[model samples]
Target: MAAPDDSEDQDALYVLTAALLTPARFPAALGDDYPESCAALGLDPYPGGYGLVIGQDSDGARWTVVVDDVSLVAVAIASWDCGMEYDLSPGERTVVSVLPGWPLDLAVAAPGLPAPHDPAPEPEPSRDGSGQDGPTAGTALRLPLAPPDTGTWGPPQRRLGADEIALHWTQWRDRTEAEDAEATGTAKRSEVAKEPEVTQDSEATGTAQGADAPGESSENGSPSPGEISHPGIRRVLGELRAYLHSDTAPPLGRVRSGFAPDGARMLRADGPGWSFVARTDDMAFVLLDEEPGEVLPVGRGSELPPLLKALDAMAVRPA
Candidate 1:
């Protein structure tokens, strides 16, 4: 298949966390030009895990360089160990470690062909020879990391182990924004007091950290966010391909994962549509089609059974 076209778009890569972060203070903390820098590097500054690469941005001061791949931004979130409600300000430079789908180049660039024993088999006829409406096997996007530019920085390895992949950072700043309403020198100190303990169990399921995942870095200037904070979660990068393709109970695609630092409520997207949203401790919501505003509450996580039932209902059928 032909690669996605990139000639028409004007977006750049390399988004400064400041540009993308909200509740507004993030921009002040990082810098005003951060979003512009993100555009220079082909990064989409929009909120949430999904982002698109358009070009490169640099003025030489804040967030110098990087490429933007939507999935990668989500993965980067894990590396930052940005807990469910924690501040992500410390992760400004962490984007450098995100290398786009470079390792899967061979597979991605390869021509499409049917599998061996590849002769097209006739579809089994239904009751009156009509084709059955069984689920059709299809391909999902599996992007390879783009090769890093000569001077660019990136993580050392391409994948991670199980437990190591589950790490994430969280803080309840938003929940406590009201508490800091009074005279405050800087809300930083008070934020610490209000910080909620992120029990690991609240994360999306199957996000176990991989103890043996590799931990190599290309530059010493700044450590990869996950390396310093959530090494195990960082390892999940290594298992990206596996997670997408594995025959698992609750198959998933891009998901806004959240968890208590302890590993309890693992939320994940469940769907028949191409998109789904599942937050571990909150709720599983599916946006089957946005044009029509079709939304549905698949399950709830506060109580485990409802969550599991929702997940089971959403699980992909085994081949």
Candidate 2:
């Protein structure tokens, strides 16, 4: 279909504005100069088919008036925050205008197609018990992760054996115990009374010998197999199970376990398109992917559900 003429679009914008905005609430003039005013405020004017005007009241509060020529049925007047990108609130306003400072971050639909933000009736509840505002099931949420390089990722390997998993659990437990002991020692030292003492030559020699004495042994004794009941570890495992069972679950491979230099147990999922890792002591999950390579930290318990949903949406089939 041929595009509407510029004049026709502008007229529609005016009509939309009149229908939605009351004169008392959004008293602002509109004309060709609307775009120019946006430029004066250090913002880019809405490209063709839209105009904008800023209105300030006696109290110094500001309002942004926006008219979209194309929609013809909707316009928006919203309270303005100088630091924020301008957008309309629901019901009271239906159209959005892009003004300068930042480039317009519009999500344009296909030509002649309605965009996701198109004015519509109130959204209905989703089947998954989440309302329309919540994420849809089966959609992958893009996480912040470093972009994947050109090199090919290797084939998926077998899952970690029971012995390897046990080793990681042992490391994690030993580290936790060591930390507890150090903390207890510190508290005790702080509470002890300081005393002055007279020292003979023999006593001085003994003190020097003690100072030179070997420190405690650097050994991490293993715990029994049944002792892997750390609350944090159990929570992580539970969340992992939920992810695997979800409808949008990614094709997760075996668990790869390692230890950090500080003796923390690091567990990673071998998968395509995305990487998941968590430290036993951290009690949180980190998602990595190609989009921005940003590390997203997902908290435990309640936060895991939404995060797992997002992870499912972002997962892709392996090459």
lDDT of 2: 0.34
Q: Please give the CA lDDT of all the candidate structures.
A: 0.30, 0.34
TM for candidate 1 is 0.23
Please give each candidate's TM-score: 0.23, 0.19
For candidate 2, the 10 contiguous residues with the lowest summed lDDT are 23-32
Per-candidate clashes come to 68, 10
Candidate 1: what lDDT?
0.30
Candidate 1: tens digits of C-alpha lDDT, residues 1-319: 2222445332232232322231111111121222432333344544332232211222111112232233454445555456443232223344433323222111211122221111122332233334444353232322323423323211111111111222321222222223334323354455654634444753443233421223322121122333334333223222332344558622222222334445544433322222333334433223322223332333232232443444434433211
The TM-score of candidate 2 is 0.19
- Off-target runs (Cα >4 Å) in candidate 2 are 1-239, 242-253, 261-263, 283-285, 288-290, 300-319
Look at candidate 1 and tell me the lDDT of residue 100: 31
